[model samples]
Target: MNTPPSPPGAERTDGSSVRIGVLAPLTRPGWAEAGRHLLAGLELAVGEVNGAGGIGGRPLQLLVRDTAADPRKAAAAVDELAGLGVAALAGEYHSVVARAAATRADALGLPFLCSSAVLDALTEQPTRWVARLSPPQSRGWQLYADFLLGAGHRRIAVAAQPSVYWASGARILRDHLAPRGGTVIDLDMGALTPTAVCDELVDRRATALLLLVGHPEPAVSIVQSVRRDQRLTESLIGAPAGQPEFAEWATSLGDDGAAIPFLRYLPERLSPLGARVGAALRERLPEAPSFVAFEGYDTITVLADVLRSHGPDRALTADSWPHVAVEGTRGRIQFSRTPGISVWQWAEAPVQVVDRDPAAPDRFRILHAG
Candidate 1:
């Protein structure tokens, strides 16, 4: 095994190190906590790899940058990381940021592994140095639609804020459910109050309401308002894996958070490794590890595996990633070389519908597995 020399800023006096650049929304308004969870998972994986003698006797060090969920910031971060000689890049939570970072990574010809961005277009084309562990937004919506119809929901009304994330989710749901004898109603959450939104859905006789707000506070408000109405209390209130998976969302909503089902990357049953990772994460994080944390951990572990097998050569790592498969905490971390989705994309990660326990907001129950 011919180990390549360490990149520019990665060579230490005592020993060589492989610097992995991590891009996350560490200080972003709506995504601060998500970024923290992502960083924590990455750090945990790096610690483990270093403890196990690292890759080829070179310890892994994370050079983290806060993208603030902004595309321009993400691009700048990539440039900085490249300048610092990072062997690979990973760990982004926002779709917009991930897309920008992916483009930059390809341009620089550096291997980049996306942890949790779900936009279908991110990996729509073949690229030299890009792959995603998270399922695309379209795939997630497919699972959500399946769960909804299986749970006997027909007249579905979607209330979503105006954002790329919300719009993509809403579009997928409408496209999947409309042709299946399901009535799909679209409401701009920005234009309606929680009360007005509830009234309109009730008037339209909606059996289910998909609250697609990105922010936790407003999502909780809408859920609370809708549940307060006696007419809407029986309605299946659901969110599309944004604020719903966060602990703060459930805690702020209190007892009202119960029974509000949401799509997430949690499997129906945790693997032994997944359980151990979850337990380890719980010790460090204020909340139990969510899907974002799992993504970060898996991304680093997969990157480590690639580095160990391919050495620190950027081109070799990029070329070899497509054939590399690692068992991630969520599931198998493998990429599909399909035409449209031309990357190493794990599109079949198990997603499930889960709801918070009213008595234990930190706990959740899997309602439906997809």
Candidate 2:
């Protein structure tokens, strides 16, 4: 299960099928369960590509490895896939898991492409073999910051989980807000009790709140606590990929409180993509509660574009590898090289402000695109 050589790109075994390793958290629980969505997207991409006559005359042979959303496990899965002689890798939703895949790919000389790891530090290296379809969290924060400042709201309170992506966003917000003479208080929730954290934000009288947590239930708890305990009535802005439970949670607020989730792709008016994904997941995957299916779908679509441009070349040559270009669910993607010798990649893509809880049936606005 760890290492199985897939069909080579140039061979006739299975008539030219290239093995692409898909590392995801198929066994994890909770809102992080969005790994299934990541898988679905990747599988969908493969199906579409194969249906169109495959990549480089070779149909994709996907070898899925469950990272279980664990860093060490993810690393192990990467090694196993490398042993299997997979041509490339695509699918890493978490920051720690993405870094693990990037590191192992560098050592093994394999191409590692992440579907959705927004940490800025992942691409600080000379490893061009590693790429990410998801834009960094800093870029996402920039979009949010610009939107907030443009709307004439100078004072902002930042609340984020103590994860690498959130930490990076917090730092970026500080740098952006300070230059404009705006005050930003770090409402870091990773260290404090949920109740205490809500109380502080409520007592502070903030003009706006930024929710940067990853999982949906934790975010739901935060929203519930903020409303129940803090008695704070303020607008919440966050990256669309932050949590999928926003619309349902926001709608439950009964029109008084709004949860404006910034997203990679907004659902159609009166028909959000999340709702559709949620329904499909409910039937197909009753065991898995929460999964980021769009993340999977988006990542695969982007990686396929890279493969389309650059055929199934095993050797990851720096100069020859074409930059990943794809119209993903998150809009346009242009990954850039990082300065340091790290495994991370960076890109600044356009983001849309999706009205998770539409006041009207046809009221989904793309407030600011990226």
Candidate achieving the largest lDDT: 1
Alpha-carbon RMSD, candidate 2: 5.7
lDDT of 1: 0.80
How much is 12 displaced in model 2, in angstroms? 14
- CA shift at 20, candidate 2, in angstroms? 0.3
Off by over 4 Å in 1: 1-15
Q: Which tens-of-lDDT digit does each residue in 1-370 have in candidate 1?
A: 1112322343343336888888888773638888888888888888899899999998898777778778888888888788878888998888878888898898889889899888877744578688888877887787788889988999999887777777888788888988887878988877898899888887898899988776665776788788789887678888776566887776677778777777778677779989999899989799788888988999888999989998878998888766877887877777766445655687667777788876776788887776
Give the alpha carbon lDDT tens digit for every residue of 1-370 in model 2.
Answer: 3322322342233435677888776664422355666666666557767888777776876887777657787778878777777778888777767787887887788888777676666645567677765666667667767777876667677777766666777778878877887778777676756677666766776666677774444665666676665356554545444553333444444442354556553333213444554455455553432334555666556556656666666663232334555555444555666453244443444456555445652234566665
Candidate 2 Cα errors over 4 Å, as ranges: 1-16, 29-33, 55-57, 229-231, 235-241, 245-258, 265-311, 316-319, 323-348, 358-364
Backbone collisions counted per model: 2, 19
Q: For residue 138, give model 2's deviation from the true position in Å.
A: 1.8
